[model samples]
Target: MAADDIAGLIREAIPDAVVEITDLAGDGDHYAAKVISESFRGLSRVRQHQAVYAALGGRMGGVLHALQLTTAVPT
Candidate 1:
């Protein structure tokens, strides 16, 4: 639930990704993550989000409650 935990999960899934996570609610549950990676180059926004969600390994709607995710390809 910590910011590092969220960033760690994303980094684990996308090894080359640059992850920046912010604790939105200061409660360790709500977060906002900005991910930049070459892997997301051709993926749609939804697909990118899905990838992030998958990276969480089913923790999206469970232990992690809310996440505002933004993904982009590295320029």
Candidate 2:
């Protein structure tokens, strides 16, 4: 999927999130993303990552490959 499509999935899952997806591997399968959301304000790093992963559904194991994720609570 395209970077915008990955970003769109995040937005669809978390309406308040600001997502930026990058093609780190340039393979359309591996990606890096930075996500900012109020929902992550108090969540731990792993929890935050889980939230984003969940947004991707089952793609993480199939269509969507490696994802290096960074998450933050918007200031």
Task: Estimate, for each residue in 1-75, the C-alpha lDDT of model 2 and write its tens digit.
Answer: 889989999999999999988898788988999999999988999999999999998789688888989999987
TM-score of each: 0.95, 0.93
Tell me the spans in candidate 1 whose CA falls farther than 4 Å from its real position.
none
Question: Scored by Cα lDDT, where does model 2 land?
Answer: 0.92
Q: Highest TM-score: which candidate?
A: 1
Clash count, one per candidate: 0, 0
| Residue pairs in collision within model 1 | none
lDDT of each: 0.92, 0.92
* Deviation in Å, model 2, residue 70 alpha carbon: 0.1
Cα lDDT of model 1 by residue, 1-75, tens digit: 788988999999999999999898898889999999899988899999999999999998789999998999988
